[model samples]
Target: MSLTDTRCKGAKSQEKDYKMSDEKGLYMIVKITGAKWWRFDYSFDGKRKTLSLGTYPDISLKIARERRDEYRRMVATGIDPSANRKASKLVESIEVKDSFKLIALEWLNVKKSEWVSSHYSKIEARLQRDIFPWIGDKSIIEIKPIEILNVLKRIQDRGSLETAHRAKSDISQIFRYAIQTDRAQNNPTIHLGGALKTPKEKHMASIVEPAQVGELLRQIESYEGTFIVRCALQLAPLVFVRPGELRQAQWKDINLETAEWRFKASKTHQDHIVPLSKQAVEILKAIQPYSGHGLYVFPGLRGDDRPMSNNAILSAFRRMGIEKEEMSGHGFRAMARTLLAERLRFPDGIIEHQLAHQVRDVHGRAYNRTSFLNDRKIMMQDWANYLDNLRKGEDVLPDGFTPLHSMQY
Candidate 1:
């Protein structure tokens, strides 16, 4: 007979555990301790087994019979209900542990060792600010391409189109990592290539004309900022190294006797040598008395332990009425690259080498750092002399500033 609600509520436990059968394989067991549980007994592959439907009052007699019928149907179909339940639980657990945020963080930790601190910081910041809040909790394997596109669209909507594209690339890399680690089946970001708007390329602002360049040189010389900053400003145009490398220059890396400044290139992490010009050496010597004993050549005004802020030179340019669109700290590089090649007529190979740019040979092998050291030394001095003449309102190319004619590039 089927168990009734009144009987289930009023029945007392016996001295031993006993059950009131509901129907089919379903029954309510009343234990000696007065606890009641619902169980379903069934056979699969000639073996008998019991499946706990739930507690008596918690799962009711009607629900117990329904579950029993369901499991019986599974057994009739040559499947075990208990095994299927276990498999579902296993999948749930894996999905929880393989969430997008967790897997992306794991990939970042593994890749951080190969990246510079600034590069790592930028990636981490982008993920935390733009990505993690959107789909971080979702399982990587189940995320659809449309869902990823929504995140990129939001970033693009905010006018950070370039950053949105970069975020997409980062997400793609994370998905690839997930695939390699067996946590994901496909990369949703891979299909989002054409979905985002491409960002327009804007060249860095610079003054390339000789007259404008001369005026800029005059303004830099008369810059009434901190003495250390003034010296750095003076040397920036002459050396034309990356602003970060210039500000982070150390005294130990520079040798006035050899007229060279040697340090690792930040972007490539390769050893780079800057052949110091006569003007550059003079500027360095002038600042030696103040920052010679410190770690950074252009230490911050507030403290000698830290390098000058990256914005120092840029801010100085602003104060001098030079808008960012007119000239940036990095603009010195473009200015030199143009004037050196056009007016001075230096070989492109020598100029590129002096710029510490990565150049490959015909075989696609990277050129050595010192590939054109001797030619660069001559070019460096000539460039510095040209700048001195410009500062004095003289010809852009002085008598000794003639380009090497006989040397084949």
Candidate 2:
């Protein structure tokens, strides 16, 4: 017989715990302390298992029967309510494990070496500010394309269209990484093409004219700042490496006698060689007395064991009456490339390789292979001497300069 609400409610607790049956595995337990509980007893695989519902007036007869009926259907379908509940909890925990934020962070750590430190910081910042708050906890596989579009739309709505595009690209990359690592099934970002406004392409400021570059070099030669910064200013044009890479240069990577600086490229994390010219070797040797003991050749202004400030080189340029529109820290590369190709008559392939760009050689070979280090050594020395002529306001002829190869290191 089915139990009535009044009988269940009026039922008193005895000296020990006891139960009142309702119907078909549904029953109410009345404890010795007068507490009551609703339970469902069922059999799965010929083994009886019990499930908890709730208490007397709190659960009531009507709600308790409804819950019991639901469980009965689950059992008829061969599902154990208790085991199903546990599986759901496990699925929920797994979902959390594969959440968007968790996967993105994992992707970041994997890319730590491949990306420039400044670029890595920007991506991390964008993920935290734009992507994470909205759907970070959502399972990567479950995140829909529309959800990603909404996140980018929010960024675009704030007039950060460029940032929106970058965020989209980053998210797409993250999804691709997730797929590669078996964390996601598809990339939603591929479907999001043309979803955000395209930002105008603005190249970094640089002065390529010979006369202007000459003056810039002259100013750097005469910079009266800290000796460390002055040396940085001196080497910027000669090496023409990325500013971050220049600042983070280590003494261990340099061989003063052999005149080469070897380190991993900031963008690709690939091995790169910068054949130091006679002038470059001179400047490094001078700075060796001050910073050779430290980890970084240009240690930070503060007394920590860190690289020099990212802005140290650029700031020195500004202090020398150079405006942002006039030149930037990255301008040194442009200055070298332009002068090398146009004025110095150097081959495009050699200049491209020296810049550490992904370039295919005349035989369709990549820059990493067929380094042309011997030709590059001569170019470095000639380029250095050309600047010397320009700084002295002399008529610069890059070809007329004596090649360093003729002289032994």
lDDT of 1 at 133: 88
**lDDT per residue (tens digit) for residues 237-315 in model 2:** 9999998889999999999889999988877667899999999999998999899988888898786388889889878
Tell me the TM-score of model 2. Answer: 0.71
For all candidates in order, the CA lDDT equals 0.84, 0.83
List where candidate 2 sits over 4 angstroms from the true fold: 1-97, 109-120, 398-409
What lDDT, from 0 to 1, does candidate 2 have? 0.83
* Candidate 1 lDDT (Cα, 0 to 1): 0.84
Q: What tens-digit string does per-residue lDDT give for candidate 1 at 1-409?
A: 7778888887789999998887788888899999899988888656688888888788877777788898887666545666545434433234466677776776676577777566799998998889978888787888899998999999999999999999999999988877765567888777877899989998889999888899999999899988878898999998999988998899889999999999988878888899998889989999999899989899987798888888899989988999998998889999999988888888888888878888777788888888879888988888888888888888657666667645775
TM-score of each: 0.71, 0.71
At residue 114, candidate 2 shows an lDDT of: 65
Candidate 1 wrongly placed segments (more than 4 Å): 1-95, 107-119, 176-188
